[model samples]
Target chain A: MAEENLKGLMLPVVIGKLLAPLPLFPLQFILSRMVRGIAQRRPEFFARLGSHIDSSYAIDVTELPFVLLLKPNPRNPELTAHRRPDKVASDASIAGPFMELFKVLDGRGDSDAMFFSGNLKVSGNTEAAVCLRYALDDLEGSVIEDLLHMGGPALMPAHLLLQRLRRLEMQA
Target chain B: MNTQAITPNAKPELVCPAGTPAALRAAVDSGADAVYCGLANETNARNFAGLNFTPDLLEQGIAYARGRGTKVLLAVNSFATAPRTQLWFDAVDTAARLGVDAVIVADIGVASYAAEHHPQLRLHLSVQAGASSPEAIRYYCSEFNVKRVVLPRILTVTEIAAIHREIPCEIEAFVFGNIGMMSEGRCSLTNYVTGTSTNMDGVCSPANAVHYMDLPDGSKTAGLGDFEIDCFAAGEHAGYPTICKGRYLSPVRKEPYYAFEEPVSLNLSSLLPDLIAAGVTALKIEGRQRSRSYVQAVVSAYRRAVDDIAAGRWHDLSGLVALTEGGKETQGAFQTKKWR
Candidate 1:
């Protein structure tokens, strides 16, 4: 009787934990699709990045627990999403907490300042890392806005929801 | 005290830092009398990744600076271990071969080798040598033919004047930038935390070992290795978590405080006249790790200041406050010891 009562009491906690991470799947899928669209639209940008990065590179959101593996193909760069931590590897990797990486990608943060203050870290080929940074700095448009535009009218609500959730997470 | 009348002609050479080829050009274009840079190797003190000049780049930079009538000084300033002495030797040789104006070196072994092998190449004692005293300065000058000694930023104007009277070599002192409170070349705090020697590896508080954690309460904590070096509250500008510049909690203190040094830049602009009068021949502006824009801004400001001082005019230093670290500046032992 006591065991049955305890299981009943703990059931909501277990369900809540399981449901929390479900939202991240769609968020990751949308982010990956957006990145692909951006790369496809800006082949020249990707080509410039490819010139600096001769091999596969990885971007890991340390806080979000997601990795985006990028293989620069010169003409059509390939970006793969690796939600599973065990499957991610690349020639070089830049890792930082999600907000910091977001600020960098959105052109709101200074990469040198972030790196100097220990908020960002790079491993593997440093030359390739530097090249990637330079390429990113030279990118012309906002990938997030581009993604939102490509998402069409239906996904705007979903994007707003994601933004709200992100805000909540930051507050938490 | 010899209150001798001002010579009106002895303008101290304005030395500037250049981490990249573009920065070298920027320094020269902005009227740097001399620009100091290091090869893209561990020989230089500021050996951050993507920074420093390649051998080819250094050659080109030397040519460029020479074209503008600016001198180029190659820094092979890091200490060499017993096994890695060849790298230092090669750097000195390359500097000489490239016809650099001077090779700034810190290691005694490297200095001795440069003195023996390349007698014609001018040698400047790096601040890393920490040769602050008259005896130490004389030893380096007598043995190594060191033409100038970059004095460590620990002495007052009075002390510097005294040293200038005693030493045969010219005195070069840092006029602006980061102030290292610890004895130069002797600091092992970074090695203690990160297991990489700053003097040997030419990296202090290396980026690889540094990590920042954003907390739930909107505060940020900077960690070096397993230790939490500092924590910043929301809206506070976070500084690079070098161990010496970290904030810590003490039993007697109510709040966390910078135990050793704060995140303030050394701005000796107000004391330039005093320093020049004290017989400092070269005034160095530190920051080989900074950007070209920073190089241009700082070099331009100091160039104007130096020219104005030479012309017996008041120097306007208010413009440089924006470029200083943490938006704060200090004279750092130049004005007073009360800062301690």
Candidate 2:
């Protein structure tokens, strides 16, 4: 009963409160940096992704205020934020709740199930979506950990806070 | 029961898994009679990223396997969704064009397409087709001109012999690797949890829906989507978050138990002779998701075992236990009916 109550009350309230005031541009910039850092750390990942996906992809965190537009440039791969969500037209767009997107990026969740259950939505080019799925599936480690490592001492608190929130959500 | 032992003259073919080109080479070099692989798309079941062969890799792998007197079977086994049937059709066309020994397929439509368009290309019914009975087998053989049927890992040696006696096609049985309890191609548990259909998408309990969290008391919880699948104690090796193998608390049972199937591998080394005598033409080892070293080790062990069985030698296969899933192995449903 307590668990049920917590589930009904805590999740939406917490997620809304945490994500509401987050500056979209700054967050998107940080995420772009994180992607760049990931590419630096694991060049093979980006290379494989580029080889498979030659188009632009928009990754929208459905619950969040930002969208990450990535172009798999084999020569120069980069992830950028769309200033206006409506402005950037991608070959493919994958939209899902923030945590679900994180789970996929971190190689921790099953994209198929999330997509099947309607938590994750894919639109436009199916081939691009498949390529992205394959690329993400091929990844071996945690995207969150890599981001935290890149953040260094400054983002340790944020990492801890995120962990705590995840724990709480799981408990609920 | 046929008490007569299989003669030393008859040797069943050893079909091995090749997820990559290197693994295909390793399998062929290690004494595999035939190696099976899929393309880097949803055409095959093991469609994990970085795994499976690309078109170029498949061509190279086929060349390598064929040069060494080994046959290569292409798995275009995933069910074709209504709108996306072209993918399956294209895969068949490619396999036929490349001259693979056989095209293993599951969906009826895909099988029909292969049979109609490419009569020269031999068709094998994938286990995902779930054609266990003689009637189903006959239908596939007659309709699709299926030369062989990869039997699901649910039949006993006796049942297999019975099916073999009744059916016109050669029988291929899984001899080792992760054992699935659910009816092949019919399971939707993973689909319920994750939006992807295993039959259509060619992936089950895909990595994206899997998450592991460290608990406060040093325990680890593995979750699939929102539900906690299993919680392991410290020092325990947590298996992948596949829904069928997960332990759960049932309404009838107070404590958590393996409600569906336990996480154990199927190692039929001891029953190689029995299977051969039962008219099993080929022995398949599962795991395209496994590493190359794993493919080498398992294939080598099974090769020696098959040879020993053919040579009328008593083979001890206990060494393979260490290489099995969770370091545990079972004969599965080959010996007994009460395998649940």
Candidate 3:
């Protein structure tokens, strides 16, 4: 009877371990979809954010790591809104170009049409934002596209599950 | 601008440091061909209390330097984050409007702005930019029309020679003052301990955070935040207690050792001829926060050495012993890679 009980428990554990990474795909998909939804609703919010970024300004962003927004001016578009994920803060503002820029970046996984459409914004000073967008789009369209495309939407959960299964395999 | 083709002079420029109006005059009168200083704020790296000059003082300093055939370069080298970028922008605008010779800059954003707004003004890449590689140097030069690049302290004389061969602009190396082992423009160890950041804020071991305690055993203890930097014997020299330069106790060794560098000043007087032969265009003496006396002495000694070498005289300047840090000096990386 004990042997039978152990076998039954073992089957579920094995199955659960095998299916663990499966959920990560759906989770990422949902997150990406939600981000897309937000981007579709508000395009101008992220567009105007860069106008306010100053060199001496310090923002305490809670939702994201404390990244130096580094808005040099509303004129130069070459400066991208780089986010240093290591230094996140809580009290920082979420309005302007940052909102839409991050949203479009987050949702790029959903659909190309969503990205190509006016759904994504290069807000603030459009000339400067366009320059920043071109740089990012070029970089993304080049070497990085392979990785993002290979993963598709399903890569997220598969990656998570693979990590867990690999750990189990190591133990076994 | 002089459009005529001119042969290069063997005597390089004598770049000096000035903190206040008095220091500026002292540097120029004592024979500084050029003096670099900043306004009294975080816009400059030497953001010390009661140091630097005001806008009025800066105008006077420029006039004084011009009158003495000495050029003045305004340093707005500190990195500006956000909201505070206006200060840097305004500083650059004011410097250009005042007909300053050049503005020493390190921040990419600041450089970009200066290039766009003030095309007539010449730009010199500050040491804080950390453009050690030829590629990096080229990028700055091509992007901002940088006339000169201040090589960082980490590169050896050989490396400097190699870089000089590749670049078209003038190369200025630090001949005297602090020898920073840590990477410039990226260090945050001091900021982690103290609120003031070395890269962005331009102030390291800011006075507000430093505390010194005189111990009973004829030793002094320097503390930053909760950590003790070093405990110096009363007779031993008490130096600037920075995190990287501080003595530490490790599990492998019980005795305290200088993990980075011993508190010593970099004096390259012995390597002047070698540096000149290496194609260095100018010699810069650091310490804008230092007093006029310090500036006068260091500048005078270097000026004499540079002039003597140009005049084809056999000069030995090792007599500048008292002016060194802890009365000890090194050739830094200029002589040999291994300083020992």
- For DockQ, the strongest prediction is 1
Give per-residue CA lDDT, model 3, range A42-141, as digits (tens): 3222232333323222222223322234332323311222244444322222222222333234322211112222222111232233223322321222
* lDDT per model vs. reference: 0.79, 0.79, 0.67
Docking class of 3: incorrect
For candidate 2, give the lDDT of residue A121.
62
Which candidate, 1 or 2, has the higher TM-score?
Answer: 1
Model 3 over residues B109-130: C-alpha lDDT tens digits?
A: 9999999999999999999999
| Candidate 1 residue pairs in backbone clash | none
**Candidate 2: where is the Cα deviation over 4 Å?**
A1-172, B1-9
TM-score of chain B, candidates 1 onward in order: 0.96, 0.96, 0.95
Residue range with the least summed lDDT across 10 consecutive positions in model 2 chain B: B1-10
- Which candidate wins on TM-score? 1
TM-score of 2: 0.69
Candidate 2 per-residue C-alpha lDDT over B138-233 given as tens digits, one digit per residue, 9 for 90 to 100? 999999899999998889999999999999989999999989855888999888998887888898877556666666775667788777899777
- List A-chain TM-scores for all predictions: 0.70, 0.80, 0.24
